[model samples]
Target: MCGLDHHDDSLLEAMLENNLLFDSGVDGLYGRSGIFEDVIERFELLVRRLGAPDKATRIHFPPGMGRKTLEKSGYLKSFPHLAGGVHSFEGSDRDHAKLLGMLEAGEDWSDLQTPTDVFLTPAACYPLYPTVAQQGAVPDDGRLFELSSYCFRHEPSKDPARMQMFRMREFVRIGTPEQVCDFRESWLERGKTMIEGLGLPCHLDLASDPFFGRGGKMMAISQREQALKFELLIPVNSEETPTACLSFNYHQDHFGQTWGLQFEDGRTCHSACIGFGLERVALALFRHHGPDVEKWPAATRKLLWED
Candidate 1:
């Protein structure tokens, strides 16, 4: 019951009993109840402690951003296995019917569609690059943007902490190479400090992107060579295995080139993001404190409820 085997079931049932289900999805339930309110209160306090932007940065809110940007960012080239895009086929009603039948039998129906221009945002930062690119050249001073977005993926497992669709509150900044690198490095320490302060046993680790295929393996190798990503790992359920709760990535002009984003100096703008998985953090709290809300630590419990 401590692992993914029962994680989804236990969390889902608890959420349901607590009336957290606002809608339903392929997974049978979705959305938040008062539970998210608890998570948000703590998150806001944490962000304030970390000196997050006083306001949401230049906003670009899109339901479905373009797929081409993901391609140019090497998303498809690197992590194709984890990437998901929208697909449709004409004259495939019969095929769709068969797929639906399989779904009724508990088989995945995603294989039936012919993917189109749309794609599932595996990471929250996917849409940010293209949106910023559309704005033309970045100012010499740089640009800062934040998006609280719902993102999707076919994850390694149905672990409650590793959801197929999760809320990601991401802060993105694009500008000179020096600025981007500095920003990312700064967050590395801040993120570690914040998580550690929350009383969660966590550690910082160099991260490698999960590449798509055999060729993707090569692209991931290149990313590693460039020292592109880092993640904060914490023990959620089992102390033997840690889960990545936060990840900071430095895109290093890769996205700027894709979106034709240039700097005042006529160089491609560098990019980086600090990502927070809201649900996973909540799950971490549950694991740390125990299932009974009454027995949870006073400091942690007070953060969630004002009344």
Candidate 2:
């Protein structure tokens, strides 16, 4: 939505209208062309405009990360429904031989093996938390880190926008609670302003996290009550359906306590993140503006291709 030109939206809508939505995963990424390049450039520009300080703090992680790291950060305990992990053979050589035989006989269930340590990263922020923690305490003041990470989830729905794997560009700020909260709030406003300025149909809403189970349900409620997460939703494929393009979260003492990160006064630090789903926004652009690149607004196209 931020980087697309007016005619670009028309072309996208036309493609979707013609049922040309390529299943980027499971089936695989194909026929992306300039559409993808534009998306990346726009995302970078958007991040820069969002006041990320500079590119030095930026990081890029492949779609997958280790399961142990995610588990240690309480990802499974919170959202086990979205958790995904790798499995491997656990049997002896004889058992392996039997399994291979089963496979040759077309009766194998090799997919049932228990996991080693690999898991799909559910969010861009997940991988960064432990890295920051292991790096030792936050500076005497604070630290700002940005990342454009490809993340994975298991919501295998038919929506082209909500793919199993997607991109997330985020800015994480870690420091004291006050600093973290302030940073989150500031980004919330900034996100809204930028979206509005771009003429996208969006709204800033109080958000509830998808915590797991009854206990997690209570935790989610309590977290929202304490103003821990906020999201910006915009209509993408359909007016009835709004995509969550941006999420602002305040992890008040959560990561800090878990990781032993300290501030200037030696108190545990707090953390917050501002995240954007790069692909989802691209989908939104298609929905709102249509898909003909040539027909896209000159101003918007210029902004996207500027850098």
Candidate 3:
């Protein structure tokens, strides 16, 4: 079986009952236990080990990325519904006193919150573009970067696999069109194999990003029709609508134009990226292989936990 019958909170309840995760009272927001964290850490180690041969330049960023960068990426226009901008109290002393009074009087004062320059990064690769453009030109041979970030989206869900805040480990490639396409095509199989190596049944499907609004319908359809995006789905939540555990995307000069990325030959660069949802992978492991790590399949255990 791919996963338990998840008509209710059976899996979430089981994990909570077993101390694998702690309820945060909010749906899609849970405090992971140490055991859960260990699994994620070891899985990331496996990802790094598998990707190490590529010599990707590793970079890390905090959960919040520059809001200006996000704006320039066209994310605000395309996925405004899902994007999350950090807001803070940027008011004067009188405003602060009013906020305190509101709290004391049981009034909602969130209206006083001000938008900050930092936004919760929607994707791991969002912050990499402008940073690379700032470096002047892509190397002659091309550029591959290893990046990971805590990303946020506004979608709240009861599905444990779909968290509002999650971490994505991504490998991004920027180069000629051929190079970018090849990178995306290669990873479609590589990512599936890696997930299967962890003993999860997975399949690849042409997919589209969750673009917002009526106009976004056309955008999503166009994305799928162009075969620009794909997802590696696992039966974590249910069979009908399985979870997207990993995603592969190809941006044909979109980011290049936006960020002014250019190759050493002065040609516009194309980019591709493959991202792994670390939490969903762990959840898949737990859902399929049983909650207790001590009793997991020996082969899967060896693949992920071997020293």
Instruction: Estimate the lDDT of model 1.
Output: 0.70
Per-prediction TM-score: 0.78, 0.84, 0.95
The per-candidate count of clashes, in order, stands at: 2, 18, 0
Maximum-TM-score candidate: 3
| Stretches > 4 Å off in candidate 1 | 1-33, 40-45, 53-63, 88-116, 302-307
Model 2 lDDT, residue 208, Cα: 80
lDDT tens readout by residue for model 2, 2-36: 33332422434454454435534452232454665
Tens-place lDDT digits, model 3, residues 1-307: 5344345446777777778878898887889989899999998999888888889999888888888888889998899998888889989999999999999999999999988899999999998998898889888778999998888888888788888989899999999999989888888877888888888888999999988899999999999999999999998866678899999999999999999999777799999999999999999898888777888888889988884
Error of 2 at 216 (Å): 3.4
Ranking by lDDT: 3, 2, 1
lDDT scores in order: 0.70, 0.73, 0.87
lDDT of 2 at 148: 82
Stretches off by above 4 angstroms in model 3 are 1-9
